[model samples]
Target: MRSITRFITTSDIVRIALGWSAFGALLLATPLLSPPVPAPLLITALVSIVAVILVCAFGVVRQAEALARRLGDPYGSLVLTLSIVLIEVVLISAVMLGPGEHATIARDSVMAVSMIILNLVIGLALLLGGIRHRGLAHNRTGTSAYLAMLVVLIALAFGLPALIGQDGAYTTAQAIPVVIVTLALYGFFLFRQMGAQADDFTEIDERLTLRAITSTEPDAAAPGIRDVLREHRTEILTRLGLLVVTVIPIVLLSHDMAALLDDGLARLGAPTALAGVLIAAIVFLPESITAIRAALGGEVQRVINLCHGALVSTVGLTIPAVLIIGMPTGQAVILAETLPDLMLLTVTLLLSISTFAAKRVTAMHGAVHLALFAIYTIVLFS
Candidate 1:
């Protein structure tokens, strides 16, 4: 009785209550969400869905980090980024297919993610980490490798379309080649990332080891070897189960969220781009939290890995997939950004190139990136 009571605190109960209530709301409200019922009700439902998504996503991030802790190094960062990117892809796909005028949603979401990671996540990570540690060091080769690939992929997937395509749009035939190129880039990177160049993604951080041990333990006292094994096995299984359980609702609720978002944004006369920003923000919440925590804990390289790796996956994998889907369905995949957005992207890439040029990062670098992010936010809403 003491153990059970100790395990279930007020915080745990609140989380459970909120999760279940959100699940119930989603199931009950999904039927009426289509065609978008009255505005007031729709707003309420939208708020509920978004709120639930944030909660569920938070749960997924916590579990994913638990899994990452056990896995270690490149694989740890890889798992976290892949999990978050999967959610991003699923959410964007749902929005694309749902009822509403969201033709450019995929493009907007992808671009939003790129900017958010490069500017917002990286900015905060570097700033806070530098402030805490004075400066942070990472594998320069690894950081450079990620940045090089990102520049190329971002250029091909986003910049090229604006420069050569018709009115910043890629036709089916044009898109086919771009899609192939992007996928090939991703495959090559994946091959090298997992094998020959794996070291490039790893960092020498003692903190990660300590963090993993603490997070994996279910109780305070140490156990016998056999008990330890059993506990480790139980922890892995529990995390895996929770990961799937939480992720499913996130995906399922996403469709409903997308519907509500599309209708609500249009009615409020919000910018179409704002829909993408909001969706990207939601999708990024988990990853942002994980990265920030890593930075604060002196695991700066992991922050770079998660933020940069996510950008690569977004452009390399998500963009290609979205384009492939759009080509067959005659949906126009808008890959180009407006002048201001493009300028921000260019500045971000340049700053990143300069920031990671060395193995060390300072507060000044972070401050510069944060300033760019500030400009980005102002322009986005203004």
Candidate 2:
């Protein structure tokens, strides 16, 4: 009884109830969205679906966090990153497979996520964390490894196609090799990240470690990751199970949500790129919060793992999946960015290299990143 009480609290029950209810609502409401509906009904459906997805995403984040904290370091971060990416993949795939010309959704969503995580999320993390704790320290080795992979992957996934005049898509001859290479490179990174070079992703600066150790008093409200591990000591499998249940509804519900989003946006005459931004925001909303919290807690390395690691997976994995899906569906998967956006991405990547080149980051770094994000927003709207 005590174990049950500890594992499933009142809040858990409430979230679970809402998640399942949302699942049912999606089934019933999806049909209504197939054809034109009254504005009130459309708004109601959109609002409800958005709410359900958000609620369940938070629940999923909670479970994933428990799992991540319990496992520790790279493993824990890996779990959370992979779980979020899975949800992203499902939502993007759902949107792609839906009606209308969504060929570029995969590309746009990936681009939006890269900007949001790299600039917006990481920028805020550094700024807020720096204010509270002077400079945000992280493992430069791991960060460099992640950036190197990203530069190469981004060039291959987004740039090469454009350069070769494929216009964001590769011919069958080109795609086969690209997919195989992307997957293999990602597999290599994973092997190193989880195996031989795992420490690169989780290493803490020696001075920071000593400071944490010598500190006599710790904040009670801001419990460290260790506290979470002890609390969820025996709930690994249980939490993992809960994670799946929560993620499933979001995945299924996304199909309907994507449909409504497309129809609504068309009616409103909003820019189509906004759909990608919205999807990216929705996909990573909870996870971004989790990263920021980690940042504020002075877990800069963990924040890196979550934010940088996520974009790595986002590009490494998403591109291949999009390519594969495009191959079969005969849909033109436009992965190329416009020249201006490409320039922005290149600057962001270069800036990222400098941001983490030093062992510690200051508030200024964060501001620069956020500035870049602002520029991205302007470019997006323009």
Candidate 3:
């Protein structure tokens, strides 16, 4: 029994691999099975949600030690950004293709995107990071700059569409130009992140090391990247395999998940805004769990980077991808006036105020954010 207990080690990597395999199997088999609508849909949604969670867990564990080794501040941020936004894009695309007669699908999508980034992503990150680190000190200048750009982008991309209306004089020709320009601006931001400008925003110190947060043995020998990669070659390859396997399942499961959500919302007399919120939640689930864990473990830097990075990537990458795809298809992907949009905006404003008001986040703050999340859930269910 003791030996068996010892053998039952719960490694994050192992769990993630199993999850990816399960999701891949489900994705490949679901369509072939063609299960009934509501049941299949619910199952698909659950599977997708689980798959995302597993993928995130895999990313966190695989990257955690490595992130601590090199590029300390900015490491987890990229992983979070890439993973969350990719999930968001997949879910959004699936939903848009589903049979939802709502003409303002694009608007709701944007609103959902905004709320998830601000409230779920940022709020939870701050809450958890604050709780773990007595006070997580972020670069105020970077935070301010990000907030400013975010506000402007939201105003231009999300807020303006509601006022403009779907049938407004701005035809496809006019909209196409705006999207192209937005894409170009995003390109510039991407360039800056990968270039010298990033140096201005990111700072690193030995004090910011993971060793400072978690009670782990510090590696005395600092190995080179090549050596490290060689040592972990199998792990890295496993992660890559896991990522591909997991993503396919998410896409497949999302098809029915979208339909069931729409049906469930309709049957329950829920608001259209609920759809957007659901999409955001599904996509952000994995990242959210990672952030929470890091926060509890007192890794504030990872929390901040992951949360803020995800917010930026969602808007910068996922939103543009949707627009680009929508344009060629002649789909009106502009933000339109909707209750969900207002709710999303309100959540964002509230998050900005809460996070900025006190540079230090505590358990109490986490409770408040969680309370807000509860309220959101209640509103959706009600």
Q: Which candidate has the highest lDDT of all?
A: 2
In angstroms, the error of model 3 at 303 is: 1.9
Provide the overall lDDT of each model, using Cα atoms, as 2-decimal numbers. Answer: 0.75, 0.81, 0.57
In model 3, where is the ten-residue run with the lowest total lDDT? 1-10
lDDT of 1 by residue, 116-217 (tens): 889888999888888998888787888888888888888877788888877777888788888888888788988887777777777755465577777966
Record all residue pairs in model 1 with backbone atoms less than 3 Å apart, i.e. clashing: none
Q: Order the candidates by TM-score, highest first.
A: 2, 1, 3
Q: Each prediction's TM-score against the native?
A: 0.80, 0.86, 0.71
Going through the candidates in the order shown, the clash numbers are 0, 0, 0
Residues 1-382 of candidate 3: C-alpha lDDT, one tens digit per residue? 4532332234644655655566666557566544344656565665655565555455554444344334434533564457546766666676566665434555556556565655666567666666556565555555665666566566656666656646522246556666676667666765665454554345433464555577566657645445655775565444444444444444344443565566666666888668667755665555666666666766555665566666666666555565666666666565544465467566666677557556455656655666666666665565
List pairs with backbone clashes in candidate 2: none
Q: Judged by lDDT against the true structure, how good is candidate 1?
A: 0.75
Whichever of 1 and 3 has more lDDT, that candidate is 1
Which parts of model 1 are misplaced by more than 4 Å? Answer: 1-21, 30-51, 94-101, 205-238, 251-255, 258-270
Residue 268's lDDT in candidate 2: 86
